[model samples]
Target: MSNGVSTSTDKIIVDRSRSHRNKAVSKAVRQTRERLQTGHVGNFDRELIAMHISAMLQGASIMPVFVVIIAGLGIYFTRDIQIFTWAFLTLSAHAINMLLAKRAAKQEITSESARKWRRILILGQVLIGCCWAFFAIQGCATCEGQSFAAYKGAMLLAAVCVTAMSNFMLPRAVLFSFAPTVLALCFRVALTREPLDLGLMAIFVTAVVFFTFITDRLFQSNLKILSFQSEKDDLIVELEVAKSMSDEARRRAEEANLAKSRFLASMSHELRTPLNAILGFSEVMSAEVMGPLNNPTYKEYTGDIHRSGQHLLNLINEILDLSRIEAGKYDLSEEAISLLDIAEDCIGMVQLRARAKNISISQQFEPKLPSLWADEKSLRQVVLNLLSNAVKFTPQGGEICVKVGWTAGGGQYVSIKDNGPGIPEEEIPVVLSAFGQGSIAIKSAEQGTGLGLPIVQAILAKHDGQFILKSKLREGTEAIAILPAMRVLQSLPAVEDALTVGRKRKSFA
Candidate 1:
C-alpha cells in the first residue's frame, strides 16, 4: 500500500488504490461536465460540445419558422371565417416554441430551463393538433370550404412533431411527454384532406435528427476522446507506483543479503573459536603432553570435546551450504552415479543415529532404478539432509525407512520415511521453504537448522527434480525426491570433443 502523502505536497492524494481509480475518474468526469454546463470550466471538449448544441438549436429554429408560417396562414383564414378566437389560440400555441427558442438564445439559458419551456411548448402544440383535427373533420362533413381547415390540421401535426424532437433531452419529471404530442399530431395529420408533403416532412425530420441526435452523439464521442487523453495523468500515477514497488523490492533484497552476510560472519568466528580449542587439546593428548591417562574419563572427556567440535563443524558447514544455495552459487555436476549406491550410502550414514535410539532403519529399492545424472556432491547433500532429518525425528524403537524406485518412465525417485511425530498437514508445504520448520518438529527436536529441508528442495530442483513432503501429527513423515536419469557414457563424447578442442586451441597458442 502506498501512503497518500509525498512528503513535498500538503494536499494528499485522495485515494491511491487502483480499484478506486475508475470511480474517481467517473466522479471527475461528472464534475467537469457540470462545470462546463454551468460556465465554469471552458476546456476544449466542453467548448466543442457547447458549440455543437448551439449549432443544433440554430438548425432546429427552421422548424419553428415553418410553424410560424403555417400559423400566419391559419390567422388569415380564421379572420375571414369569423372564428378569430380559436384561430388565435391555434396560431399562438404552434408559434410559442419558436419564440421560446429565440428568447432562450438571448438569455443563454442552460438545457434544464430550456427543456421546461420546451415541455410547456409541447403541451400547447398537443392542444392545437386536437383543435385542428376536430375542426377539419367537422368542416369537411358539411359544406365548409378548404379555407378554414385545408392544410391546417396537417400543419398542427408538424408543429407537435417538432416539439417532441426538441424535448428528448429533458432531465426527468416528464414521463411520456412526447407520446401524447406525437399521437395527437399523427391523428390530425391523418384527418387532413390535402396532398401529403412527404418531401418537406422528410426534410424537416432529417434536419431534427441531424441536430438533436447525430450531431449530439458526435460531440459526446469527441468529449470521450478528450476524457481518454486525460488518462495520461493516471498513467503517470501508475508509473510512479511501479517505480516505488521496484525500489521497495530492491531495498528488501539488499537488507536481506546484508543480514545474511552479518550472520555468516558471526557464525564463522564462533565456530572457529571452539574448533581451535578442540584441535589444540586433541593434539596435546595425542602427543602424550597431557600424560597417558589410565582413567577412562580423560578419554571420554576428549571424545566429548571431539564430538562437540564435530557438531559445531557440521552446523557451520550446513550454514555455509545453505548460504551458498540461497546465493545461487552452486553449479550442478554432470556425474552419472548408481542411484542405489547413493541411496545406500545415505541410509548407512543415518543407520547409526537411528540404531542408538533402537529405531529399526529399513531400505528398499525397486527393480531397475537407473543411474541419475547429477552433481554427486549436491545429490548426496540432498539425500543426507532428508535422512538426517528423518533420523532426528524418529522416536525410540520407531522405524526409519529409505526406498529407491522408478518415477514415471524416465526418472529415479527416492523416498525417506520415518515413524516420528510427523509434521502437521498445514505446515508441510512451508517446511520446504527457507527457515520454515514445522511446529511438531520444533516441539520435539533437540536441534534443527530449519534450512535443511529448504536446502534439499533447492538441490533437487536444480537437478530438474523436486521433493514431496507428506506428514500427519503423531504419525510419520515421508520425503520423496525424483531426478532425471541419464544413461552411462551419454556425455563421454561431448567431454572428449571438448578435450580435443581445448588441446587444439592450446597447440595453436
Candidate 2:
C-alpha cells in the first residue's frame, strides 16, 4: 500500500480546470453584453466596419454593369452625348470604393482604425453621390413633358434604395451617398416650381428617409447576431475545459484510493507475524505455562498485554479484509451453504458476549429453508459481524432479535435488530463508510475499527446480495443481509423421477 500525493506540480502543466475557466468566459461575455446594453458599441466597431466593407465589395461587381445600363437608357431617351461622360465618372467613383473596401478587408481593423476607414469610405460614397448629382441636374432636355421628369425622379429613388441596402453596415454612409443628389433635385425644383417637380422632390425626400431608417435597423440586427455567435463560441470552449478537468480529478482520486488499499493489503503478513508472537508470549505468561509468576502485578500486566494484543490483531485482520475487498482480490470459496445454520452458528458465537453484557438474544428462524449457492466463509463472516455489532451496541438486559427467513423473491435474509440507542438519520451514511464511526458509536465503551458493517456489505455484494441498515434516533437499529433469489439452490428431483427421465432418454436413443 503506497501513500503519496497524486497532484501534479510541474509548472508546464496547464490547469484547464472547468469551473475557473467557465467563470472567466462568463465574465467576459457578461461584460460584452453590458457594454452593448449601455450603448457602448465602440468595442465592436471594427466588426461592424468589416461587415459593411465586405457587403459593399460583394455587390460592387454588378454596380458598374447597372451604371452602364442606366447610361444607355439615358442616351437613347435624351439623344445626349454627355451621358457617356456621366457613365465614365460614375464607374470611376465605384472603382475607387471597391479598391478601398478590398484594402480594408486585408488589414487588421481595430476600433481606433475603424473610424479612419469609415471617413474614407464615406468620402468614396460622396464621390459616387456627386456623379448622381450631375445626372439628376441634366434635366433630359431633349425629352418632353412631365413624363420625363417622373422618369428622372424614379431613377434617383432607385439609386437611393440601392445605396441604402448596400452600405447599411457603416453609419451615415447611405445618407451621405445620396445627399448630393437630393440637393441637386431641390435646386432643379426651385427653378421650375411646377406641381410635378414639387411632387418629385417630396417623393425623393420620403424615399431617402425611409431607406435610411431601414438601413439602421439592418445594422442593429447584424450586430446582435455577431454578439450571440461570440457568446456561443465562448461557452463551448468553457464546457470542454470543465469536462477535461472533471475527468482528470476523478482519475486521480481513483488512483489514490487504489494505492492506499494496496499498501494496507501488503502489510498483512508483516503485521500478523509480530502480533502472533506477542499474543503467544503474553498468553503463555498469563497462563503461567512456563512458570508461575510470584508478583500479582506482573500477572495482571501479562493478561492486559494478551488482551491488548488480541484487540490489535483483530483490528489488523479487519483492515486487511477490507483492503483485499477494495483491491478486488478477495476470492470466495463457494459451496452449498445453509444460511440458517450459519446464522445459528454466528448467534452462538456472540451469545457469550451478549450474556456478559446482560443482553437477551432471541432467534426466529423459518423452518425447512433451502441451502444457498454461496461462499460459506463469507456468509459466516457477514453473520458474525452483524451479531457482534448487536451485542456490542445493545444495552444491558436489552433484547437482540435475530431472524432468518425466505425472501419474497424466493431468496433468503438474516436480520439482526437490537433495542439500543439507534443511529442518527444523517449518520447512517457515515457509519456505512469505511472506518467511519457514528457519534453514538464513537462515544461507546465498546469501540471498534468500524469495518464490521462495511465488510458485511462488501461480502454480501460479492454474493450478489444487499445489506440494508435502517435506523432512527432512539428507535433502535436493524441490519439486514439479503441474498438474491438466483443464489437459492432448490432441491433436485427424487430418485424415481430421475430414473424415469433416464429411461425415457434410453428409449429415445
Candidate 3:
C-alpha cells in the first residue's frame, strides 16, 4: 500500500511538471512566430502590396510571349513531344496565375490577405520553375553538337532574364522560383565531367548572384517611392479634414451671431417703451410742471431717476447700433460733409461737461481742409464718442486738444488728444473690444458702460475710414479718425469760385 501511494504521488508530480514545461514552450513558440510575422514582407502596407501585385501582373503578361518563342525554337530543333508538352503546360499554368494575380490586385488587400496572395503567387512560380527544370534535364540529356549547346545557352539566358524581371517587386519570391532551376542546370552540367562545362556553370552562378543583388536594390527603391506617395496621400486627406472642421466651426459662429442680432432687434422696442415712460415721468416730477413736491428729497430723487434713465437709453442705443454693424445691416446715407465742421460741433457738444469738470478745451483747425464723402450721422457719432471719452477720462484742470486737418497721405483726419491717465499698451486692445473695461477704467470714479471706443470704431469702419488710438502710460491718449483718400473731396476750385463771386458782389454793392 505504501509503495502504491508513493507511486501515485510521483505520477501526479510528473504530470504537473510536464504541463508547466509544455506551457512555456507554447508561449515561446507563439512569441517567435509573432516576431517573424512582424518582420515579414507580408506585413507591408496595403497600397504597396497592391502596387507590387500590379507590377507582377504586367511582367507575367510579357512572360508567356517569351515562353512561346522559346517553345517554338525547342520544337524546331529537338522535335521532341515531351519538351512541347511541358512548355504547353507551363504556358497554361502561367496564364492561370496571371488571372489570379489580376483578381488579387483588384481586391482590397489586408495584411493576412496579402500573405495568402503572396504564397499563392510563389507556389505558381515554383511550379513554373519545376517545368523549366524538367525541360533542361531532358534537353541536356540528348545533346549532340553545337545546335544543342546553343539551345542550352538560350534556355539559361531566358531563365536569368525571367528571374531578373519578375523579382523587381519581390526578390525573395523570385529567388525561390529560379534557384531550384539553376541548381538543376548546375547539377546536369557537372554530370558532363568536362572542364569547359564546369567553367560555364561557375559563370552562371556568378551571374545569378549579381542579378539577385540588382533585384534587391530595385525592390528597395520601389518601396521608398511608394512610401513617399502614401505619406503625401495621407497629408492631403488630413488637410481636407481640417478644412471641413474649420468651415463647420465658422458656420456655427455665424449662426450664433445672427441669433444674437435677432434677439437684440426684437427686444429693443420692448425695453425702450418702459424706459421712455420712466424718463418722461421723472422729468415732469423734477421740473415741477404740474405741482411742487412737498419734499426736496423727492425732487432730487426724480432728477437722479431722469439721469439714470437717460444713461440707460443711451447705452441701449449704442448696443443696438453695434449689433446692427456686426450683422452687416447698418445703412449709410452718404453725403459730402466737412470734417472741421463735424469736429467743431462734437467739441461744442462736450464743452459743457468739460467745463463742469474744470477741463480746458483747445482746438486747432487746418485752413481749407477738403470735405469728406461719408454718412453724416455716423461720422458725427464717431467724433462725439471720442470727445465724450476724452472729457470723461481727463482729470480736473487737464487739457483736451482737438485737431482737424489733412492726413499725410492726402486724406482728412480728426484727432482728439487728452492729458488723462493714459491706458497701458497691453490694455489698449482690451478697451477697443465691445463691453471691455480696463483695470484703470474699472477703478475710476466716472464709471462708463465701456462701449464708447468700440462704437466709434464700428462707425468709422462703416465709413471706410480708419480709427487709431495711441497711448502712453502716465502721458496721454490720442484717438484719430482718418477718412480715406478716396473720400476726400477736392475743394480748391470751389473755394476760388466762391471768393471771386464774393468779390464781384462786394464791387456791385
Candidate 4:
C-alpha cells in the first residue's frame, strides 16, 4: 500500500546501498576530505536551501526589459501614459507569490495565510494573462479590414502568446492558470472572422503551458538526485576518517613495540654480564685440570654446576634473540642457496636428537627443486629449531619427515611434518609471540624457553619468507618454510663479519 517496503532487513539493505554510493563518491571527494581535515561539519537546515535560491535569483534575468520599454514608449507617445500602473499591478502580484513560496519553504508562513495568498496569486496571474490575451484580440477586431487591422492584430497576437506562455513556468500551474487566457484566445480566433492572429497566439499559449508543467516536474526530480549525491559525499568522509584512525593506531603500536625492545635490551645488559661471569667461573672449577674430584658427591656437584650454567645460558640467549628480532637487527645473510643442501644439513644436525627418542628423521625433495634466495644459515637454524621441537614433543616410534619442494609461483618450501602431540588451538597464536608456550607443553617439556618459534618467525621474516604452522589437537603438526626462488643480488655487508663485538673490545684497548 505504501511506496516503501517494510521489513527488518530493509534498513540493512539501505545501509548497504549507502555504502555502495559512498564508493562512487570517494573518487570525487578530495576537496571535501580537505575541508573535513580542517574540522568542518555539515547540517541540514531549511534556510540553507532558501539562501541558495535567493542567491540564484539575486542576479536572475527576466523578460521585463522589453515589456517595460514597449509599454513606456506607447504611454509616452499618448501623453497620458500610465505604463507604471500596468507594470506595477502585474509585477506586484507575481512578486508577492514568489515571496510567499520562499517563506513557505522556510516554514516562516502560516498554513492558513499561505493557502489564502496562493489562491490570490494564482487568480491574479491568470487574470493578467487573460486580460492581455483579450486586449490583443480587441486591437485586431477594431482595425478596419485594412492596414491598421493587420498590424495591430499581429502585435496583439505576439503579446498574448508571450503572457500566456510565461505563466507555464511552474508547470503544475498550467491547468487553472491558463483557463482564462484559453477562453479569451478561442473566443477571438474561432468565434469571429478575426485576422487569425489571436488564433495563432492560442496555439503557442497551449504549448507553453504544457512546457512549464514538464520542466517543473523535471527540476524536482533533479533536486532529489542532488540530495542523494550530497549524502553519499558525507559517507565517503566517514570512511576517510576511519582510514586515518587505523593509520594512527598502527603508528602507536610500532612505538610501543620499540619501547618494549629497548626495555629488553636494558634488562639483558644489566643481568647477563654477571650471569656470564658466574657460568665462566663455574666452568673453570668443573673442568678440574688439577685432577678429577674423587668424591661421588663432588662429581654430582660439578654436574649440577654445569647443568645450571647451561640453563642460564639458554635463558640469556633467548632474551638477546627476542630483543634483536624486535629491534630488526638480527644478523642475516642472503645468498643463492641449494634447497637440498640446506634440508640435508638440518636433518643431519638433528638426526641424533631424533634417534635418541627412537624417532626416524627422513627427507624428501621434489625432483629438480629450484634454488632458494635466502640466508642459508638463518634458514638452517629455523628448520633445526622447528624440527627439534617436533622431535622433543613426538613420542617414541613416531616419524619426522622433512620435505623440500618447488612451489607453483617460483617459491621453494621446506616442510617438517611430525607425528607429535600437536599444539592446542588456543596456544598456536600465542606460541608465535614472545615467551608464549602452551600449558600442557610448559608442564611436559620442563626445559623449553618458549622462544624457539618466535626466533623461527623472525628468521623467516628477514628472508621475506613465510613460516606457517598447522596442527590439530592430538594430531601431527606441520611447520612449513616457503622462500622466494629467485635471487636478488645486492652488495651488502656480511652479517657475521659485521658483528662489532671484537671491534668494541679493540676500541677499549
Best by lDDT: 2
Candidate 4 residues 172-249, lDDT tens each?
A: 445555566556667767766555545455555666565555646654544555555575676678778978997999
- Runs in model 2 deviating more than 4 A are 1-42, 51-59, 65-87, 129-168, 179-262, 291-300, 328-342, 361-376, 401-415, 454-468, 480-509
Candidate 2 lDDT score relative to the true structure: 0.83
If ranked by TM-score, best first, what sequence of candidates would result? 2, 3, 4, 1
* TM values, all candidates: 0.55, 0.72, 0.71, 0.59
lDDT of 1 by residue, 383-441 (tens): 88888888788888888767766555346677788888887788876787777777866
Query: lDDT scores for all predictions?
Result: 0.61, 0.83, 0.77, 0.63
* Tens-digit lDDT string for candidate 2 (1-509): 12122122211222121222578768877876775455422257888898888888778767887788888877777788888998999999999989999999999999899999999999999999999999888766678876667667777888887788788888777788889988987998899887887888789889888888898898888877777666666667876898899899989988998888867767777888888999999988988999999999999998899889899989988988888887789999989999889987887788788889888887777778789999998999999998888888888889988877766666788878889999999998899999999999999998989899899989988988888887988989998888888999999876677889899999999
lDDT score of residue 242 within candidate 3: 72
Give the clashing pairs for model 1. none
Candidate 2 at residue 452, lDDT?
A: 92
Q: On a 0 to 100 scale, what is the lDDT of residue 346 in model 2?
A: 86
Error of 2 at 499 (Å): 6.9
lDDT for residue 212 in candidate 1, whole number 0-100 = 46
What's the ranking of the predictions by lDDT, best on top? 2, 3, 4, 1
Show model 4 residue runs off by greater than 4 Å.
1-48, 51-59, 65-254, 285-323, 366-373, 423-430, 433-443, 446-450, 488-509
Error of 1 at 328 (Å): 1.6
